[model samples]
Target: MSAQHPRPGITHDNRFFWEGLAQHKLLIQRCTSCHRLQHPPAPMCPGCHCFEMEAIEASGRGTVHSFVVAHHPPIPPFEYPNVIVLVELEEGTRLVSRLVGTPPDEVAIGMAVAVEFEQVADDFVLHRFRSAASR
Candidate 1:
């Protein structure tokens, strides 16, 4: 691990998400009963209140719905001026991630984005988003 980076904890429910990052793919959970896509993978369907959920790969396309520029570093390994974005995927699911490859002032609502990963450690990867140059 880089001295400037630290691994984030991965829970059982989110292990698949990290695995997908290692493969450069974006994964999310889909509710079989309601056909709604969810992020931060859940054990049950929030829409239908059912436990029937499936892990699915998303198109990796999305737009920034909202964002905030971090002025305070939470810890030593974290950096200031980071951008926290709420990206709304094409599948209609919103996920919280850091926006990369662009300045905070450049981030805007409806801005196109694609999935990218930052490997913090051998088994720890973080999913971030970048400005999508291609459709």
Candidate 2:
């Protein structure tokens, strides 16, 4: 039902991030050898190409570094005029997710945001953002 909520393509490299979301936690991969943070979960660290990595729990807080108001090319399971944001996490990694609980015009660069999870299906959850000022 509801297109099965589109499960993520999990792999050995990124399983930790997905499992962490199932536990309602946000995790980023840190190169245990080089001490740099990475998102989208690369198998090798870009800094030193180390295959070793560790999970770090993110603060679940970030600032709006950039955003775009998507008004065209509607897709199923999502509303049009979506407010998409590129958030720079407190840990310094940037991620793109939909921004909620704030108007598109109200969103601005440097605005603080906090992570929130929404269950799109019984077995899947998605990360979204809301203004921290709304917290």
Residues 47-107 of candidate 1: C-alpha lDDT, one tens digit per residue = 8898877788988789999999988746656666788999999988899998887887778
- Give the alpha-carbon lDDT of every model: 0.82, 0.89
Measured against the true structure, the TM-scores of the candidates, in listed sequence, are 0.85, 0.94
- Which model scores highest in TM-score? 2
Determine which window of 10 residues in candidate 1 has minimal summed lDDT: 1-10
lDDT tens readout by residue for model 2, 109-131: 99999999888877777889999
- How many pairs collide in each candidate, listed in order? 0, 0
**Model 1 stretches with alpha carbons more than 4 Å out:** 1-9
Candidate 2 local lDDT, residue 41: 94
The true-versus-predicted C-alpha distance at residue 16 of model 1, in Å, is 2.0
RMSD of 1: 2.4
User: Which pairs clash (backbone N, Cα, C closer than 3 Å) in model 2?
Assistant: none
